[model samples]
Target: MHDIMFHKKIKKTLSTIEEVLNNNNKNIDFDYLLLDNMLEITFSNNKKIILTSQIFLKQLWIATSNQGYHLLYKKRTWICIRSKKTIKKILKKEFFIQTNYLFKLNLLNNI
Candidate 1:
């Protein structure tokens, strides 16, 4: 993908995360910080899920409490090549494992 498109995707993804967290802030006990190239969500338990961008590779990555996934642009979605899972899927699963809170994200709409 082109640099602009890759960056746009990353922005959209982070914004989606922000929207979800803001909407569920009362129900979910978590805090988040958005940086120039990264988004970090910290749970009440102190576990974190972080997303970062690799501009040179035009790629996005997610680091959960237990594992990390490199997301490649495929079919207009960011998907893990090995697990063939979308970032949304990996995030939902991992957050539940870490915090026992089911994250409701409209990332599919962004996709």
Candidate 2:
């Protein structure tokens, strides 16, 4: 993918996550901060899950307190190259592990 397209996808994905976190359920267990190409999610227990765009590698890097995953955009979704999981799956699992809450990531369905 072109660098511009990769950046756009990253931005859109991050923005969608932010929207889902803030709008859908309003879970007080966690809050999110979105940067240019990164998302920092802090849980009430002080654990964190980070989503970073690696433009140089054309991938998304997600890190939780206990694990990390690298995902590449494929067939309109970001999928882990090794695990073969979608970004939504990874984020959902990590969010639950970090916050003990299930996030309503409805807007991210298309990503």
Candidate 3:
């Protein structure tokens, strides 16, 4: 029961992230983790979120039923949002893709 709810939340969150990333030129970093039955998502800005990590995809499933919100994080701070509602709120802000000089340099060097 709880497992189903958790996966739906994760999928919703992931979908939102992917959508935002696709629309923006700013680079977004994502570190996915599973600790003690919790799924942890660490963003490049140092924001993190912990939620139940379970796989639930039934024939009749809905994602919006779960909460959604956004979280703000620094370049490498530790922040966690436990619900989807919070993730949505955070994502509403301006999103940018971060490109490091080193990465650009490497790309240039390669080219």
Q: In model 3, where do residues sit more than 4 Å from their true spots?
A: 26-85, 92-111
- List where candidate 1 sits over 4 angstroms from the true fold: none
C-alpha displacement of 60 in model 3, angstroms?
23
lDDT of each: 0.82, 0.86, 0.36
lDDT of 2 by residue, 14-46 (tens): 988888788645656777789799999888888
Put down candidate 1 lDDT per residue, 1-111, tens digits, no spaces. Answer: 788888888888788778877876777788899998899999889999899998997778888869889888888678897799987788779878977777786655546
Candidate 3 lDDT over residue span 1-111, tens digit each: 366654454555444444444444345456655444444555576654444433432211112212333332222211234432233332332122222311111111111
Off by over 4 Å in 2: none
TM-score of 2: 0.92
Order the candidates by lDDT, highest first — what do you get?
2, 1, 3
Clashing pairs in 1: none
Error of 2 at 70 (Å): 0.1
Sliding window of 10 residues with minimal summed lDDT for model 2: 23-32
Better of 1 and 3 by TM-score: 1
Of models 1 and 2, which has the larger lDDT? 2
Winning model by lDDT: 2
TM-score of 1: 0.90
Q: Model 2, 107: alpha-carbon shift in Å?
A: 1.4
